[model samples]
Target: MKVNELFKEELKVINMGLRSFADDVKSQDVPVLHVDWRPVAGGNKKLSSLLSKLKSK
Candidate 1:
């Protein structure tokens, strides 16, 4: 599947045919599954990096 990486999320590309009611009714029964990835980096690391680079007020 052509996947894009952004917003720290992975998405599956669905075809228009699969979205139609006729396809759902006439086609063989199929199941769709979704998988999610967990964050590898801690929140503190991201915050500290930003804080270190913050422009002085």
Candidate 2:
């Protein structure tokens, strides 16, 4: 239950939603897995539908 014990194994992290946070973690030499996140339809339903249709082609 100590920090050292917890890190006895390689530490891995999945960074969600924030690229700057992940970059900071990487700067400290830790491995970071970044997932690209965005708001659904970017808050625009019409644009979302248009993008979806374009991608289906």
Candidate 3:
């Protein structure tokens, strides 16, 4: 479909990591799914690697 089709569709948002943005969208009566998300291992490389290894088990 054309890019303009996106504008014609209903606006729904999956807002991750920012409640304020979801709130703003909800204020405009748009559907929003807010997710409380953060970077893996708090942006630490070592811990992220460790977690990734564990997930492979």
What candidate 3 gets wrong by more than 4 Å, as runs, is 49-57
**TM of each candidate vs. truth:** 0.20, 0.52, 0.65
Per-residue lDDT of model 1, residues 1-57, tens digit only: 324454356432334333464345435444433224333345578875676577443
- Give the per-residue lDDT digits (tens) of candidate 3, residues 1-57: 676997999988999876999999999999999997888999999999999999999
Best by lDDT: 3
TM-score of 1: 0.20
User: Cα lDDT of all candidates, in order?
Assistant: 0.45, 0.87, 0.92
Worst 10 residues of 1 by lDDT: 31-40
lDDT score, candidate 1, position 43: 52
Clashing pairs in 2: none
Which sequence of candidate numbers ranks them by lDDT, best first?
3, 2, 1
Q: Which is the leading candidate under TM-score? A: 3
Could you tell me which residue pairs clash in candidate 3? none
User: What global local distance difference test value does model 1 have?
Assistant: 0.45
Q: Global CA lDDT of candidate 2, please?
A: 0.87
Where does candidate 2 have its weakest 10-residue lDDT segment? Answer: 36-45
lDDT at 54 for candidate 3?
A: 100
lDDT of 2 at 9: 78
